[model samples]
Target: LHISSSWVRDSRFWKLVDQPAPKLESFSFVMERECDVEDNLTVLPRIFQDDMPKLRNLALVNVSSWPHNRFANLTRFSLEHQPPHIRPTFPEFLAFLAASPKLQELVL
Candidate 1:
């Protein structure tokens, strides 16, 4: 699933991404605009918590914070254009990396 829109900053859009989809493997969420307080955005989890076993590639564009969670099968992950104010701290980013044991390619 590829979602590229400013609307992705809305948490409701994340609910759609969180829904169980057995065939979901690769997910790319792009937000054309940076989120602000008016957006009422919160830290979003990686999206696939216990589901999406086959998920391998994940990408987030112009996002805020990503929760630290393990995606055991994930291979490729990318994050782009996160503003310093909303970007994950080094420790948080490191925790995310530690979680994805199979991660091979990473783009920041």
Candidate 2:
């Protein structure tokens, strides 16, 4: 299980990388705060699209700007570490969580 934050910061690269991570079981993204952030999904399409097969847990600790829209098969998650100034939309976050097919628990 591995959790990671921070997208590569390049939508082109994200799109390229997003298609071949099915082996990744556990994933997370404190989706690092970079100097700039445009479209979180357009850049990194979440961190659990194909990451399954071995994934059962997750830990996404990103800021509110990030569009949390995917995390499947996560039996456990630690989606916290929110900064005081961050205010992510629960609906988007929930939508992302809904992407998970095996998510059973979460810890924020």
Best by TM-score: 1
- TM-scores for every predicted model: 0.76, 0.49
Candidate 1: minimum summed lDDT over ten consecutive residues — where?
Answer: 34-43
What would you estimate as the lDDT of candidate 2? Answer: 0.53
Q: What is the lDDT of every predicted structure here? A: 0.73, 0.53
Task: Give candidate 1's TM-score.
Answer: 0.76
* Regions of candidate 1 where Cα sits further than 4 Å from its true position: 9-15, 34-49
> For every candidate structure, what is the RMSD over all alpha carbons to the true structure, in angstroms?
3.1, 5.2
User: How far out, in Å, is residue 22 in model 2?
Assistant: 1.5
